[model samples]
Target: MEKCRASSRIVIIGAGVSGIAAATRLLQNNFHNVQILEAENRIGGRINTVYFGDNVIDLGAQWCHGKQQNCVYDMVKDMGILHETGDYYSPIKRVRSNKEVIPHELATKIHDIAVKSMPSGPHPVVGSFGTHLAQAYWRRIESELPELDRTVASESLNTFAKHESSIIGADNLFEVSVREHIEYHECDGDKLLHWGTKGYRRFLRLLMHVSEDSPEELGLLEGRVQLAKKVTKIELACPRKVILRCEDGDYFEADHVICTVSLGVLQEQHEKLFTPPLPAAKVNAIRGLTLGTVNKLYLEYGKQPLPDGWVGFFCLWLEQDLTELRKTEHSWVEGITGVHMITCQPRMLMAWVNGPHGRHMENLSDEKVLEGLQWLFRKFLTFEIPPPQRFVRSKWFSNPNFRGSWSHRPTKADERKTGPWDLESPVLGEDGHLGLLFAGEASSRNYFSTVHGALEAGYREADRLIGHYTSCSAKA
Candidate 1:
């Protein structure tokens, strides 16, 4: 039996933020024998950015949700990376379903109110977020508020719901937790730092910096990362040693393995991937969590698409019945939970789709997707619109490497009442030796479903091993 060495053979599964963070931390702590096995050829798991001509299009993560307290923000900001500040309500250009052009001042005011006045406390009678929202709107309508106030309030609430639901990645609002509606890690000054051409992938390379040779020195990390290496199985009968098998017939042995694969993948392949099966708790944790889909539709055009210096388009169907519209099959635009025109990039427009609609939209041909967008434009805009020159889209749900975009508040019956701790807990063998470990945004209790959350989890898992092994070595 090969003895476990803290400095040798630490395998990290997945090349996402969590995996990369883990590998870097291990190296920092003098554990050089680390290997990163990424399924896809690319590095960043969900923080992917690509270019269309001169414009930068982020098909995955686009913003640092909270800047002041966010680690991602701290790193990027310190690096002097340039980005634009943004939010849900863009005043420069927008189109609502009611055909009303909302003034920038009014839009900002309404957005502020809606965010500050989010309904507090759990809804005992209303379990679903959709029902809760409906009830709240009806209650407001019954109030003595002025007609203008009511209109503004209605639009604000609807906009908030749609935007937040997109962030949650749940198609049906009812599926979202009424109690857990507010994200726990939401920091003060909820600033949205939009990454332009710099792209979020900059952070992956930033995090990989370990050697003192130069800022760009990632020779160790670059060599350790094996892209296109899909881990098929993990044989862990030996307490001090484990073996990993890849689809390409390559094999590797490691003393410890950190499984940073997304919760969605774990739920799908846990039974088949682990040898002798995981314990009931670990299996239950995987089952209990929910993985939601979020897709983006990127459309590019030649020259200035809209009015001179105008940003992007925003289609807020204020009067449309969202609940009924979601059930419709023909309205492909309806599948899009929200649409935003990139203010910084005038030639591109992006639409966000969540829930099952995300999957449906991704499966459609490029022509079909464009047709749906056109239908939306004709319905919402009063003026004639031109077709886009080129189009691309995201299929995070359909992609086996990432079954879903992010994690969401799981249904009560799906998860243990103790919360996401079990989901993040290290999967240990029956003999009480640590055999497998877990880390990801889903595993993070405070920062779940955020890029920083995933990074923090990776750092935490690495620190865990650092403390455990280093302390043991000292005693020995």
Candidate 2:
């Protein structure tokens, strides 16, 4: 604590979870001169909750992924925020073109088989996930399960792949990295919890600032945040200091700057964003790592009864040929993968949009989206459903601030041994002074694409600065 410098001016770019966490941690460590610059008017860069009809919907990040090792889960649980566990074990109905509900047990069995068949070993990232998946499936079909119907097995594989791709937020499995996918950090349990839009927003508020009425309120990180300050350029050519210029023509100077912008944004603006171009190593890492979109469409229907115990409406495109669907570029709705029926809020249905399809979905009007969904449900389900009273779409891909939802596994083209560590390395001045540090989910090696990963990244960078100042203060 003696190494703490209250006068050190630290500026954080982007008010996402990583940025917010970094700011809060700095303030906690007695770093008083800190400022947070946010591109959007509101906080929670990717963790957004929107309201529609009578219910609150999480348009952005929805789940804790795991309970035990997850930092986000621990904090929310301690706060006593209301959330329900996702029923992955719950029966997924495979709807036939003739409207037959395939037995739940059969569907679960297929799911289990698919999970067991995930390709293991050192797979090069050169080819897409789809290619690896096809090879893996063929091997499994021929060697392991020769007795199973080929068509049924293929459909099951497609369903599972589509779901997994949505989870990765990739445009297609082909865009995913097989190596990175294999290396991802897996948490303790399969348990997932969703904090309704309002609950999540409250959680964000708690993370960013202290409450006035609460005795524990520190209030150091709250008012320092400046919203809607889109940082266009970061000039770090100077040895001792760096300057950040915003889109709104405002300028801020700081001894150390922590950038928490999304990987998508960095991909789009890396060359122009930095005054001195980034190192080829950093550029290659950025190009090698991919950012994927996972948008959600919320619909409110008048109290409809879904399956008895099922929490989700899984749509298996049985009518469409999997090969043909994969080949076609115009088949955007094919990516309108599944709908999550909220058990807590009965009337709401959240449809998932992944990758390039998410951008395509954003182009269509609300009526068109509704029409497509209606047609899809009518073709699969036995029940004749009424039109949704209202609908909201999350256009994360198109949002300039976000560009995409989250980071995905790196492709083979990225030769760097460490996936995101290359990006996480600090940019230094001529004098070897730390001018900039990167903190975000994309920059995290073990926790990429998770909120906890982002939070940890924020803390990591804050600590880096603290350690530096501590050593300097001691020497002085």
Candidate 3:
């Protein structure tokens, strides 16, 4: 390891996983002077852990996603959290159709073939996933899964494809779409899926490990992180450094600042915050690209325990044509979607809506949606669902800090324009000499949305900055 270097004061904005990870790296690299300037009072920006009585529900990210290359899983491997087993490719026992339940292992085989058809090298950067992979995969899904209702598999594939396009089905999969765009940029070709039966949202579980210790104690929990403080503006003309101003009237400054806030936040409030202003290209990217949002509608009910071999899904068609079903937008997906009922121990049924459909749900009152869910229960289960003793939803888009889930899938034209985003030079001098640096999931070319992606970006930027410093010092 390199010996301790100059104590250059660095200010890191945003306290989410990426921000924290960057701080952790600076300190670990023996960079003595590092301070994080978060706009909010809480450290975990989007990574929120809420307790509804006894449930440790995650409002932000929970999944380890692509467990094979997950930084989160590596961090928690030694933490000793009970039931934290890795079971991504769990069997698909129930289909939203009117046929016998397909065997879990066999269903996964069919799913694998579908994934194989996906375009290699960065998702979303290509054509609409709904048109390509979803349609193509659905075709294969039906032919492969024999004895399965042809229409049921088709619908499932379609819905799955929409997820690739929609905010919900993507990364941060259970809820937000921030990670989905990230995953598209990072992964080699395929991504893993964790069922989360033991605990779906693993990202929060990992963050719970970080603030567990203080610096002196050498444990991650001791670090104090405040929640709820929102930043209003930021100025980089602090003579010798950068200063951050929040609506709370608190001010902070340091040598170099890492503005790790979400692109969504930039899209919403940057114009009001930055004095000198970001370049047109930067501003346009923030505004031109839409801030996608989606919410997971969780419903709880008393177990009615359906008959044996009932095989789920009252629909004989929707589930069968899964491929085409994903294209079904807004109101259409609301009706024919999801395995809302099953005899799991937790007894919580969830349906995720994305794109315009998600916005519709977000706009409606909880009571109205709850009423609609009641009707759904009666329509599908032939019984009324228990008015959930508890209810929860993630409002990432509505939150001030996170304007929307995260960046959308990169586009084809973006490649030539934003070509080699990796080589675009870190936050540096006006002459590109290297005074400032940028690091975050958005900055990620390979590992965009995942924790690993952000971590890798931090490491890459750190290396770039360190190299420049080393070269200058050596020349002297």
- For this target, which candidate reaches the highest lDDT against the unseen true structure? 2
Candidate closer to the true structure by TM-score (higher is better), 1 or 2: 2
TM-score order of candidates, top first: 2, 1, 3
Q: What is the TM-score of candidate 3?
A: 0.73
Worst 10 residues of 2 by lDDT: 211-220
lDDT of each: 0.73, 0.77, 0.52
List, residue by residue over 99-156, the lDDT tens digit for candidate 1. 5666777666555554544545533422666666666655544553334466556665
Give candidate 2 regions above 4 Å deviation: 1-4, 76-79, 82-86, 120-132, 141-145, 196-198, 209-219, 305-310, 319-330, 413-418
Q: How many residue-pair clashes does candidate 2 contain? A: 2
Writing each residue's lDDT as its tens digit, candidate 3 over 1-476 gives 22224666666667776776766666666666766666675566666655542355555554455544556556655655423323322322434433444566655675676677564544444444445565666566657656666665665455455545443233222222222333454433224332233333344334434243332321342343334545666565634455667677877655566666776776677789775676555654554444466566655545433344432332223433434545543243453344433222355555555555555666667776676555544544543357776566666666677766645444432433442253224444344333345666666655554556566666666565466557756876
Residue pairs whose backbone atoms clash in candidate 1? 288-414, 312-341
TM-score of each: 0.88, 0.90, 0.73
Over the stretch 120-207, how does candidate 2's per-residue lDDT look in tens digits? Answer: 5565546567777877777767776677777677766777788888887776776677776776776765446766545456656677
Alpha-carbon error at 8 in model 2, in Å? 1.1
Q: What value does the lDDT take at residue 332 in candidate 2? A: 65
lDDT of 1 at 93: 48
For every candidate, C-alpha RMSD to the true structure in Å? 3.5, 3.3, 6.2
Candidate 1's displacement at residue 410, Å, is 2.8
